[model samples]
Target: MKNIIITGTSRGIGFEMVKLFAEAGHNVLALSRNSKPISDLNLKNVSALSFDISDESEIVKLGGYLQTAMKKVDILINNAGYLVSKSFSELSSQEFKECYIVNVLGPATLMRTVLPFMKKDGHVVNISSMGGVQGSVKFPGLSAYSSSKGAILTLTELLAEEYKESGPSFNALAIGSVQTEMLEEAFPGLKAPLLPIEMAEYIMDFSLTGNKFYNGKILQVSSTTP
Candidate 1:
């Protein structure tokens, strides 16, 4: 069975991913800021880790745990993210910084920590957003979120090129809104046609086998339901 690592396991996309991976019999290292919900799942193949992605000290400790917990990770999905919707005039600098910290830097740091443990031909999928998709769909109050995803797109391209021969395949999924708490918060009272379970299935398949021939791609995974 492959070893998989996924972040943001407290709920939504992360939660569904853990469920699908463990049920598929893969060894899963599920990380979340509040992992108690995952622990309650009681799945043997899933190991829940509690820590915010933005917390460096927590990430360092998790790195240590990873050293002894598994010899190789076949997939690393940087699925953790944050969003704060505010108009340009109302958005604070601190909020912008925090958004980038969770949405961009956290993934970068985690990737660095887990690189040595990645198996040959491993896959790394960074969860991005259609909100960040250039010239496609633009929302009014997502400057921080959009820019952060743009940064992720760049990182995916650079990393894919930097380790073309040795490192894992890197890609970003610029997904549209999926039905989740995060989505509800981002656009209150609006319903998304896509579901978290559907996204999880796609991610599991991609991480397990589909991405072997792809690299540096920023795929727009979305249903055209506006």
Candidate 2:
């Protein structure tokens, strides 16, 4: 079984992923701002932590924990994301910062912190948004959220190239709308075609095998736009 680390596990896709991976006999480290949701599951193969990805100290702590506990990581899924839907003219600088911190900076930092614990066959899966893909349909209120995701797409490619010869492969998934709490909060009344569990299953499978077929590539997984 592989040792997998998944972020944003308090709810939605992350939550489902934790269950799926553990049920499949993998060791899972579930991280989120609120750990109770996963903690209550009581899965033997799963360990949950209240992690704030935007905090540098927390990231450092995570690195230490992996060094001592896991020793090596097989899969790292950067799934946590932040979004704020507001008119461009009314968007605050702080709002933009918050978006980038959670969506871009946090995941980028996480990859760096986890790199030392990964092997050549390891995989780093970055969860992105369809809105971030250039030429894809764009929405007005997501300037900050979409742009931050776009940054992750480029960062994935650059990192993959930088470490091509040494080891772990990096790739991104530009996903579409899903029926999630974050979706309801950001765009009320809009129904998404996909469910969180469905997406999580795809990611779980990819995290295990995608590295063999692709690297530094952004796979657009969407049938609808936000």
Candidate 3:
């Protein structure tokens, strides 16, 4: 089985993903802002660590911890992000910076630090939002969140091309809205078209097989209903 590292694993999709990988017998390293949920799992194949992804010092600590056991990481899922719903004029520069750090910089820093441990033909799956894509339906309150995800999409392509010779692929999944706490925070009255577990299953399959057919792509996950 592959060695997989997933960020934002305290709850929602990331939490489900760790269970998916662990149950399948892969070596899973799960990172989160709080470790209680993952710690409670008690899965033999899973190791949970807690750290705020937006903090550089914390990221460094995570890197150092991984250096000991991960000679080769088969997959890295940059799944942690922060979100705040507010109109552009109401949003502060600090809010944008915070969103950018968690959504973009955290992944970039973690990806760079983990590069050496990535095995050949391994994959990096960046979690994004459909709202990040250029042609997506614009939501006024999601400007900061969508923009941060857009930036990650760009990074995915750049990294994939830059590491072409190394054989490890990078791709971004601009996921459709899933029924998670994040979505509830974004749209309180609406029901999502997908659930976290379903998205986790899709992500797992794509991480294992999509790199061969599609690398450096921003695959949008959405439904016809909107």
Q: How do the residues 77-147 of candidate 2 rate in per-residue lDDT, one tens digit apiece?
A: 99999999999999999999999999999999999999999989999999999989999989989999999
* Candidate 1 local lDDT, 1-226, one digit each (tens): 9899999999999999999989989999999989899999899889998888898888788788988998788899999989888898899999999989999999999999899898558999999988777777688999998889888888998999988789788988988888989989888998888889999888878777756768888888888733
Cα error of candidate 3 at position 214, Å: 1.6
Model 3 stretches astray by more than 4 angstroms: none
Q: Global lDDT for candidate 3?
A: 0.90
Candidate 1 clash figure, as a count = 0
TM-score of 1: 0.97
**TM-scores vs. true structure, each candidate:** 0.97, 0.98, 0.97
Q: Rate the local accuracy (lDDT) of all candidates.
A: 0.88, 0.95, 0.90
For model 2, name the residue pairs that clash: none
Off by over 4 Å in 1: none
lDDT of 3 by residue, 23-90 (tens): 99999989898999999989978989877888889877777787787768899999998999999999
Worst 10 residues of 1 by lDDT: 204-213
